[model samples]
Target: MPTPSLPHKPITVSIVSHGQLSLIQPLLGQLDRWCTDSIEKVVLTINIPETDLLGGMRWSFPVERIENPAPKGFGANHNAAFTRCATPWFLVLNPDIRLDGDVLAPLILQAGADSGLLTPRILEPGKSAPEAHRALITPVEILTRNRPGYAAPSVPSWIPGLFMLFRSATYAQIHGFDERFFMYGEDFDICARTQLAGWKLEVAEKLLARHEAQRASHASRRHLYWHVTSLLKVWTSRAFWRYVLQHGGR
Candidate 1:
């Protein structure tokens, strides 16, 4: 008789809503359609007070909703959700992200023993090129990033927070995202820390997910302030500099 295959480790998904139920509705629908078997549960954190729209909805996996009394930062919301994660894999997904098919199966299959974090190739809606596959950040690179003829590194040092799948152990090892990063820059910090802690970051090249970019920082003064301040914090962080030194960022 043939040997039986081992059961796959379940994944718990974490999604934070900043008053964007319209976007989460479609994302939840996609997850329901494509990820029934892979996802064990979803920990949904409502960072801001919003009308209860998801109470009436039913899903294949349990949906644990967290309604915060006040708004929390991006990292704080996800970190709170992470505390509720009971699965082997913990996924942090942006509200605006859309899934067309089973993205989790491929990523889980490709993750090696050393893989700490993994993300699918993220692309903007209606665009062919990938977005947010970024090089290591440095003071010089930040100054010249948008200048004429600046080249990005061949290998990515960090994946954005839009879609990050963390092994539960790795997430615990690194202590999760720095809650000090109110809105932005936590992704880079977490990626840097993960690598510094001897965990490998992997990307599934063929698997694709679409991001409907909100670009809120471009329009909102409060968001822009958060973005700028977070960048400063990241630049001065020990993990960022340590990663740069170890990896030889140009």
Candidate 2:
């Protein structure tokens, strides 16, 4: 556990709400309570039109809202928000993520010169165990996931976008998430490119956050279609193969 560092506020958080303002409100409250000292401001993207519940609310840091004229994909929404970033750190946070304490301090303190992306251990609600980190993405890896004694790599090959904290320069160097990916596979794609560009993906294991999992693709046909198509795109991408060849798909 790290103490809150208030001398400098270096993080600019990016959160996109696809009509999940209810969830965003509470998440924003947690950030206000615990991370206000570390965060410069919050860039919230309202991907679809909704009631303006945040009109009179206040926080220690500024809350800049981007009301989209039309809905954009996950990468597009966050990429648009990045244009407003002026801090050293950029966080891509999910609306459902809840924090009990200051999670940003430890991550910021731990980031080395070569650290490109970092994340805290993500837990499901009421669970003590951390969520599984992902292995490298390939068609063969996907098809063989359920085989006997199959195991994901001990070191994560990719981090989910749900709670990625990026060095702003590293993100700019990698050119952010590929907009070609609409929703699902962009996380894996970005993580792969981040490592291929000679930067380390570090995890702050002592810090934790709870993710109230939405599991949207499970219930929505449209979302499921996007997930499948995005996986196909990742499997066919140059970045994926380059990572596999260079890193040996560890």
Candidate 3:
């Protein structure tokens, strides 16, 4: 991918929140400071009803809150919000993530470099480093951690979706994320689509974000079940098999 000069327009940041009002407030503050006038808009898609807590919030950037009554899956909600985004680039962030200014600079730099799809190094909250080199969206990686006898492969076949930056034009061309995938596989699906479309995906090693993993998702068995089912769906997809073969799957 050819590196393009930074566009004059601000990048839009979109976040999908279920019931994480407490965590999101602070995350928004951090984004306001780091983003400043560079944030074209901050849109939050909430499954819960609109409330005073949302109203009282103010940031250095413009923020918009949209109420999603049907409560579709993560990918669907993001795709729905993308329909309203007008920026040249858009970032999809989880509500529970805590980001630093230094991390944001590198990510934006990388995004400007590729102008396709960019992902940041995600760390477990409070951890000094990343949880792993890469994450494979397969049962093997999920079922076991890297150990003496059972070491998960360091390089993943797919990129995790927790924090992804996308070129709005390319995303629109590919129809954004596949709404069919309620959660897990959407990241892989998008990466696969980008690859198939001859676009490049880059990892911003210098940028980092701390994720409070699955606090809300683990609250219910249904979420876990959906995540598992979604993984299975990806494994069965023809595109996934092609991805595996092209990447020399284990």
Candidate 4:
């Protein structure tokens, strides 16, 4: 086996594959073409082997494939990859997301003195600009944000997991995503934890990427179970109460 070279970039990129070779495969091509100089390593993790992850991968960095026999939850899958990541910063990217521009350079610059949780503006399937980044989750605000005419809060409360960049040390300190959350709320859970620990939750509004988001929770029973359970766990936690108090305008 020939050893592929790694990029000189400081970010370790990871993707948790639920056997979606069709989606992930194309994203790898996009990364290879658009962001060759921006990522140090690419780790593809899966619980099943429906497809060879590196079958046609031709990225600038080394591509790693790890398959776990047992069922792997979303957080657990990424946490497993994080163990092997060797970069100052790490990125969690969904297979359907396509990187088109110099996304990481801007994030790396914005993450300067403070390295918290950094994210970029994501262009959904069809929209003018990207959707607004939201405020922290709260019981009342949750209802309000969904109400007919409520306004989006000024600051970013949480970043979507579609493309999250974390400072390696900060992630280690927060202990990464709480695997307790099988999926869904883990994104908000980690960002909330980072904020409580005094790390800034940054949004690189100037940076851009495309997400062909598959909102599968409502489409499948297993995913729905993980979704609802994670919501219950996060909303009922003591940390959630603290978040509500500090950021809830209470």
Ranking by TM-score: 2, 1, 4, 3
Total clashes in model 1, counting residue pairs 3 or more apart in sequence or in different chains: 0
TM-score of 2: 0.94
Q: Against the unseen true structure, what C-alpha lDDT does each candidate score?
A: 0.87, 0.91, 0.74, 0.82
Tens digits of per-residue lDDT, candidate 3, 1-250, equal 8965455544788887777777788888888777665677888888766444666667777788788777788788888888878987788888887877745445656554345787777888667878665554667666665555665445544567777888888788888888788867788888877766667777776677788886545777887787778888888887777767766664
Worst 10 residues of 2 by lDDT: 1-10
lDDT of 1 by residue, 59-143 (tens): 8888898989988888988899999988889999999999889999888877888999999989997777876457777667779
TM for candidate 4 is 0.91
Off by over 4 Å in 4: 1-7, 139-147
The runs of at least 3 residues in candidate 2 whose Cα sits more than 4 Å from the true structure, single-residue gaps closed, are 1-7, 143-148
Q: Least accurate stretch of 10 residues (summed lDDT) in model 3? A: 149-158
**What's the true lDDT of residue 205 in model 1?**
81
Winning candidate number (TM-score): 2
TM-score of each: 0.93, 0.94, 0.87, 0.91
lDDT of 2 by residue, 1-250 (tens): 8764534899999999998999999998999999888999999999999887777999999999999999999999999999999999999999999999999978988888899999998998767799766778767777886678778677889888899999999999999999999999999999999999999999887789999999999999999999999999998999989998998767
Taking all chains together, the TM-score of candidate 1 against the true structure is 0.93
Native-to-model Cα distance after best TM-score fit, residue 166 in candidate 3, in Å:
0.7
Best by lDDT: 2
